[model samples]
Target: MSYKGPEPRRYPTAPWGAGDSATAVESGKLPAIRPIWDVHIRDTIVCLGGDGFYYMTGTTGDNCWAFNDGVELWRSRDLKTWGYLGLVWSIDRDGTWEKNWTARAGVPFRALWAPEIHFIGGNYYICHCISGVGIGVLRSTTQRPEGPYAHVLSDQPIKGGIDSTLFEDDDGKVYLSWGAGQRIREIKPDFSDFAGDWQDLAFDDSGIDPKAKKNGQPLRRVGFEGATFFKANGKYYAGACNKDEGRYSFWFASSDKLLGPYAGRHEGPPGGGGGNLFRDKAGRWWQTFFGNDDQMPFREKPGLIAVEFDAAGHVVASADQPFKPFA
Candidate 1:
């Protein structure tokens, strides 16, 4: 396949307005909410449609009741404003499938995390966590933004058992990457089974206690699960949760090819980009991911932050905050 140059689209405007004239968290429009609490946003993408518009969705909290803790964060186009769209899977509180399995009499469905939706092969596929059931997919028949999506595949867990993300490479190949245990594998054309075999893409080698150890825990260093892949300037970039603690940071790697030999600086080991994205829109780069801790305390609302990135894709997080919308 011939390269198509940066995927033909750009992200929504940065939280603050554009250019060098605005201030961080511009005092006009209401702040964009994370929708799920506790669950720090791992990856984000602009969902595009054939009709010339885009939508938004990400794995946050459970659709039931968790801060930013939703199955999918629903956006109403205008990016700044959003609403809840329930769970992508059909397992409601009292559905046939729910009654037969997870909700049988009293059994409950547990954590659902890192749900990423993408449009592929003329259909939409939602890759998410169904607690103990492993990485799952929900397909939408029509090109509609909202879906009463149903599970198409649930064979096995993707290693870490959650934070599953689906990436379709430029070569018409699809791959699934997830956490709890970091893994990556090519998926069949149907987005069902593994295309070839599953492979480990990240990890924490030291086996030390991930929680108690300070900043040097190797066990916590590379255990990232929320994998998001994007191509730009002849490179494939995969960004994911850096570690389970210490400010919910993220790490990124670049490869000349889609899947292997990814090389870059590791976050915990030394120097590296700490958060997500290095750009926003209109050639303006905004580093973003998780801001604060958007939970019970409104002040602790872990919003999204966007900063500027240098030509080498390095973020200067310590620089003066930009006068952007989501400051």
Candidate 2:
């Protein structure tokens, strides 16, 4: 099942035209939402670095489903103005086990998907998955966000799944979860390997997604793909992408404990699937966006939406959401 197709473009040029930049909506303009960068990306994630900048990266490339080079990145100071850092990690150059291509459903592809940047323990870490392969974590050799990144696990994937995300708990223990948050395991403190056995995460009120069913029965899970995990307000939140009534959306479940019997499945931020939630420097909550459905304001461009947790501990888009696509 190796990729035998023509050599795809390595680090395809971003479609940004002259004078274009990664600019956010004007400050203090509560409801004026706009795309940060008018470039193609999916699984958008933004993380605030210890050096006082926000780093953004995701599934990039012209035809990511077929092939692409590696992880691309951009940085912002106040989440307003951004500057590109170019391809920080390349498959053909830096990858050891990750360099091999594989076929998915009879189609040969070798693209990186959903590479999320996390500033954990004063260093940057990226967890990503290859299209038909498994997931791996990379650490910045120089402790910078744009790194000469090397594998945390040198010769193998950390797990076999997609949309892998890392969560650092209050006690400083980091855990890895993936495949729509269906399975989770703690990573060793040194980022070398898994620390324990895989644990299943369940939702007490998991509902069936009409679009995703088996045997004519609806499938119940947090989401079909693009898993995101974070801790906010002392509760562990696990989120993933799902289609709600044909609209790509973000769904989440919360648990008092890390390995939940997480309760309740609720949709947050309509048209905001395949992205993660993050807090800005001012401690304001926001969710990444890359419109993936027809009903959205735009498609395949990186955006952001203001969000806040409800009284019941559910993440919900704020009334003053900067980008109200559904409105």
Candidate 3:
């Protein structure tokens, strides 16, 4: 049978197998490939905190494709054990314009999609999108991840795009890109508003994906959604998601400049799409994972896959990958 929507949220009586033990993870006895927590989450994003912890947030709620609450977060010291931070931001209490409901295909849909938490300029900020509406950013007043958060762009969204992501360059300049890297703009140093107008980004080479077509022609963009940006090894990388042979794939393209005429896109990690990439406290590269396709080992649960740059600076699955996807 074909898939419908996400499985209805069911509260577990007791915690299920929460991956390997913390000792195993710390001692390097196990590879970090399993779901960190058993919960229904999509577009999982993890960022290293100033206090030496990893904070994770994603598209969360009972029915995210329809309606639900605001952003929920989880904290981890070792990446093996996660502590729930509860609903840090709520649409009902904290949202100003974000509380407005928007309809999707004749259905009233209002849920936070892909809320990314980042520690930038000595403070914590979250950029999120509301389906059918647009994207908005929030800042932690107390400089904490579990924020008593407030909207940076008051009473309106920053832009009309989904899967909004923030990338902080080495010089501490922050850029916001969304909708699979279709548009990007620089955010002000104070997180007030866009410092510059949106620039369109595209790849030089068109990727082959049978499912991604526009007016009977193949789409040339990286992927249809889930834009991620990061600078690695002195090169800027823009990543997004696409379906290849029924499996969700993370595709990336690189360029010397931020606003790219990026090189041709290539697949990064198979079955690892709709997520972002980040380095841990130890400076090791990793990609956030929440399986979105049947080829994955599991579905709709947060997972992590170790990644490394190849000789050509392409992100690929690391040699220590534990939970390999099905062939």
Candidate 4:
């Protein structure tokens, strides 16, 4: 099947979808991330696949407020030009079980939301949130990035929460985290079920509530979500976003242990668009996010920014150009 959406942009240089044009037009040194045309709101998960290609995914459902479509799968090599792989999973895919719960809970009307894709155990596993109650898991047995991933959790194993994140530790243990001050769960080896009880995280909270309403107007939300946890410098850092409150900021908290006694901090400027902070194959770090909210018009464009560390160990994200000037 083929997708008819935003064709990658026609750069000043030449040719659309022609031979190696993306890599050939590289802006070397800095992390180069261009718009994944017609894509929006999907989680920005950038990881190098075991197959020697760089991969990423976005929630495609962001357009539903106006378009009514659901999630679609995507992959890229140079992080510039992206391919609309296929719709591996969606909320309205014929007889989706999520329809049952959404109809009952009154949230089914909401479009398909935040999704995450990861290359794990030589298999590609993806997770999607069911309104904010739980998450559905999907798996692809094949070796390709554009997966015909099967829903592993049609019944849905996540006990609760949305904007869920799937994380694998150094020991190969997988954990799921989401919502505000969410619990982290360890998944069984087979990815068939969640193991044991959920654990609470220790956060040195400084962010505001993203869902808070004021006297007459809704206050800008600053509460945390999109908790992308990863290991670096031999420690675990929970990289997450704080939306609205003033502007979008990517905040992080670090700890020696996987579950933490942590202090959270936010990156400024190209702040605003909440995203995932991940490392590429060459050891360089980058943060990828979409332009959202009144940040519409910019809805279909996703931006990538370079992240660097200071001598003091602070992660300073470069949000200068190409990236919408938010703050």
Candidate 5:
């Protein structure tokens, strides 16, 4: 666990017996997400896996901030010291994903873009993506991870869907990766459908490379499209997000199972054009994407960077070590 870069004194403290609501970490710093919503924010983040920590949902503000990103900053059993569980679900007319499918699609889907909060089988789904439709799944019947959820797929229409992502795997199966820009699909386990056909895995236009040409042209296929898949050691990684060079980049590919012949994939600029990949369980790798808030100064601010991967995985971003959510 020693790639050592920004020690900041290895933040995270509370050990001794841990509790007082335990929370520590600020060494070389690197953990600051601030903004928990007050208005105007979109597609920020949506990580989920609770009971042990990690729940970052998005789309905050408007319609009385319906679920306002469901705001709940931090919590961790071991993702490092994070202890902030504030806002938990809202927008109700009777619940059921806000009174039956965003009020019968009459508008006000509020905060439902990439919500993803899965616990599966035993039940706890929450896969979202709605502003115009495409993917949805919100069942939590009860076992609460802060949910009043229960949308059971929300009717239909998922061809080139939104940014949804849900995976179960340990053998129970259940997969559902979305599509927005680069297209990907694999949902079927009664999650209501979609599981065969729709796998464009980016790098298209015939995956150009006219001799690595730059200004001379050739090398098009740019489209990472927010894909997601995970598993370590046993391998199966697939992380994406490439906006065709307009500035959102991150990429990854690997396989050993879960459909993919992906092996040793590559992209441009030491891997920014690649899409983000943040693996942790000790393998220690980080890669978050998105840049250009159009010269900051408050232009809606959108710039996140965290790079560091090497062990042959290439990307070694100047030894990045900022995201220390808790040592």
Candidate 6:
């Protein structure tokens, strides 16, 4: 891997249209809502699909470590209001996807985590990640926001990579970026396997070591998970979440091509955390991230923020602004 260091991205930063959450509340709605209020969805992906609806899917369960429930998908038309669609498919149905599964306290669930859905080639492709098996691509042609997807990746190309995300370039070339030791792989045209070798997306010890500790707590390796990749302004951008030193924050890197020596992987605008970026009707960029709170003891709130490319060629987010339920 040729690491050429950071680039100059002079991106701008501002809020999307002033979304009125207060107006919705006064009109009799929730001030803030955590869709699946019970379990913890540490990471997920949400996007405004081609079908003109906002679709959200994430890892959820009956408890902390068990896959009691499979991945959940939610749909919202107005962004402010959301409703449960159903599981893209669950472990309850397919017990052979994962190995070494033992029953736990409650009803047993399959070991599924960090499932992401991407719409491409006029079809829905889900980048489903199981706990220990590998990442598989599920495809659906049903004309529904929530998909009745089928396992398309018989080869199961990527192994040991979690939080896998799909980014299709302007030329219809597809790339998969996954965390838990960040790596990128290009899918073949047939979608049966990866086209080439897996490329290292992040340096394991670029700046931080795995055993390093900060303020007494162990600091996470800089190669965080839940990476969302996209191409903008003729450059490849990869955004991920990480703990610089025992603290959670959003980070991103840019490259000149689909796979390259990443440049300037760093945190987001001040006070922002992990978020998934999406474009709006006006072609403006906005991100939806969770409030920095432990869902176990407190409520986890999700909100939207605007992002722009700075003049230095860096992506800057409007972190200082408050999250609005609607946009």
- On the 0 to 100 scale, the lDDT of residue 306 in model 2 is 90
Each prediction's whole-model lDDT (CA): 0.46, 0.78, 0.77, 0.57, 0.44, 0.57
Q: CA shift at 256, candidate 3, in angstroms?
A: 1.1
lDDT per residue as tens, model 5, 42-133: 33343335454544444434331232334233344544344546445543433343333343234333334445456666556665555444
1-327 per-residue lDDT for model 4 (tens digits): 122233322212211222222221132322334455545444556667787677666555423432224446666777666776667655556325555433323322344456677888888877666563566677775756666666664455445666777888988998877765346888888877778678977655444243333554432222467667777787777766665434345566667787775554544324324456777777777777554432222333566777766654557655444433334
| Model 6 poorest 10 in a row by lDDT | 1-10
Instruction: Give the top-scoring candidate (TM-score).
Output: 2
Q: What TM value does model 4 have? A: 0.73
lDDT of 2 by residue, 1-327 (tens): 133345533343434222322122222212345677767887789999999999999888767776778899999897778899999998887988778767666655687899999999989999999866889889999999989998885468766778888889999999888778888788888888778888877666545444445666533467888888888998888888887656677888889987786766788866567878988888899988876765555567888989898898877767775544344
Candidate 5 local Cα displacement, residue 87, angstroms: 25
Instruction: Report the poorest 10 consecutive residues by lDDT, candidate 5.
Output: 16-25
> TM-score for every candidate vs. truth?
0.61, 0.86, 0.85, 0.73, 0.29, 0.71
Question: Quick one: ranking by TM-score, best first?
Answer: 2, 3, 4, 6, 1, 5
Model 6 ranges off by over 4 Å: 1-40, 62-64, 99-110, 141-143, 155-157, 201-222, 269-275, 292-299, 319-327
Q: If both were scored by TM-score, which would come out higher, candidate 2 or candidate 3?
A: 2
- Summed backbone clashes in each candidate are 33, 0, 0, 6, 9, 14
Give the C-alpha lDDT of model 5: 0.44
TM-score (C-alpha) between model 2 and the true structure: 0.86
Per-residue CA lDDT of candidate 6, range 1-327, in tens? 111113322222222222323332243311333232332454546777887777776655434244435557777776667777876665555434543353434334235666777777777777777755567777774845556666665744456656677888888878776773256677887676678887765332245333443554533333456677777787777777766433354676777865555665566542234446777656777665543433111222345556778765566754443343334
Worst ten-residue run, lDDT, model 2? Answer: 20-29
Report the lDDT of model 4 for residue 51. Answer: 78
